[model samples]
Target: MADNDNRDHNRRDRDDRRRNADGGRPRSGGSGQRGYGADRGGNERRDWGSKERRGEGGDRRSYGDRDSRGGDRQDRRRDDRRSSGDRDNRRGDSRGDSRDNRGGRRPTGARYGQRGDDFTGGPRSGPVRQGFREERMDRRAAEPDLPEGLDLADLDPLVRQDLRVLSKDNAEAVGKHILMAAELVDDAPELALQHARAAKNRAGRVAVAREVNGITAYRAGEWKEALSELRAARRIGGGPGMLALMADCERGLGRPEKAIELSRSEEVAQLDREAAVEFAIVIAGARHDMGQHESAVLTVERMNPDRKDDSFSGLRLAYAYADALAQAGRTEEARDWFAHVVAKDEDEWTDAAERLEALD
Candidate 1:
């Protein structure tokens, strides 16, 4: 019995040693269980397995390296694309800025005055602008021989010639100088005309001074004198527009009959469309007032009605036609023309319908 117990104890001890070597937990010596070290090693193996899920070689270092490298490459690609986009945007902005600068930097006024500023060209600016320039450049009484009052060096090459003709000390020079300054004061037209007359004895004979005198006389309401000067200008180099303007001045002075005669004159036949319209409108109005209804209708019919699309004159005559028709007791026809004007939104012709309605 002693030998049997001893053999059983030896068997248990061997089994315990086997369990301890295998890294398992030993519950009891006789029960043949494992040690604490065996449990710890098993836990460490489980940690390694968890790490191997995301990394090679069973460690977190491998996963960290992969994630860090991938992030760096992606960030570099994004930075490169952003910088390229920024560069492209800058280039487009520069092109747009350059275009805008070019447009605004050009001198528009200088170009507009090109024809008038040219020495050989008749003059700078239209009639109104030229008149204004002459008024401003006229020498003052305080400075005699130098009438331009402006520094010659500062004057544009364009205006220099016109200024030169104005600097002489003759009678015309003084008269023109005073007249030009007087023009700045609209109320001094008569006084300036007197000054122009006085300068005549100084300069031998200046037609320009005579013209200035004539204009001043006209400004003072001397219609006969205006007609005289304008007629003399016409005898010289009067253009179509100039002739028409002279005719308008005569008409304004209560001489529409004389004005109408000039329009049919051989030399004034080349009047521009606008001047023709003006002449026709005045003639029509004149005939209407003089109780010449047939003549007024003929006057309107003479205008190029097709050009209505290009100018206001056609429409103007249309209203006049409607008025004449109503005056002649033609209500139905007049209403059609008046309605046509209304359809086109002509506020000026709206009264034509009311006139026709009065007839109705």
Candidate 2:
């Protein structure tokens, strides 16, 4: 009887060890107790082992089994942790797992089989969010209202020729907007910009419309927008008429070096006399902006300030030369040039009178 009891006891010990090695519950009738995966409160704990060893309806997998299933162990662990609400509550989601509930990762478009527009990790709150908001607002902004008595005939004939590519109604509307922009540019630059924007919205592909919009934007001190529209105009029209304005816009934006570089471009040679003179003035202004006053004076000298022409370019050249002379500390010469500009500027286009008074 004692020998038989010893044999039975040794056999039960072997069974307990074998159950522990298999990560299963030990023999309940023996001194060994249940292990981690044992059933508790009628709920069977998940078995992290091979599917072949798991009972029916068991979907959990161990590290080695997960490796054969074609995924890293860490990914499997993350999925297991997420599925167990108790585990997630006990230990917060791991940062290494990007798909956690805290919203730290970009959407995996393939997971949902649909693309998402929100590329940012979380709710965007900085410049990126502001940019999207502004874009939406721009798309929803109300169109500018046309003023009474405005007509397509008021637009310049050259500009009207470019609008022919648009539909008749759209061409007329764009032309009217351009005319309003031109008329209001000197007095109400903001209103002019509205009209210009209206024209661009209606006839964006037309070079003349873009040119007018750029000019109005320049008048309104929108240096960056002015530069962009002017570049678009240049590309579409293949004209150098607005090169001076574009360079001046660079000066307005505090990019004097870019203004100078633009002035030196080969396209400057293609500009008409007035446009060339305007470009030269822009170069001189850029030189002044860089504190190269003496160089600015030299730039203006190349335009022949001694010429007696009383045209618009002549007045602009004289005013710029006088300003350069003033900046260079040639006070007497500057005073003389300013007086000349004041005499020839019959339309009071320049502030030469004020400058001359200040010099005196």
Best-fitting candidate, measured by lDDT?
2
lDDT string, candidate 2, 252-331, tens digits = 89899999998778888788878878888889989988999999999989889764887888888889899999999999
lDDT (Cα atoms) of all candidates against the true structure: 0.52, 0.74
**Model 1 C-alpha lDDT per residue in residues 1-360, reported as the tens digit of each score:** 999999999999999787655334333333232223334543211111122332323333211111221123333544665565566566665544323353322223454355443322222334675565555445233233324553334433432332233334443355445445355328677565565444432321233444554566667777677667656544332344355456656766787777767767776477777667767766776666667777877777787454245246666667777776666666787777776665554566357556646655
Q: Report the alpha-carbon TM-score of model 2 versus the true structure.
A: 0.59
Q: Please give the range of 10 consecutive residues that has the lowest summed lDDT in model 2.
A: 117-126
lDDT of 2: 0.74
Sum up the clashes in candidate 1.
Answer: 8
Give model 1's TM-score versus the native structure: 0.38
Off by over 4 Å in 1: 1-165, 168-222, 241-245, 248-256, 306-310, 323-360
RMSD per model, one decimal: 37.7, 23.0
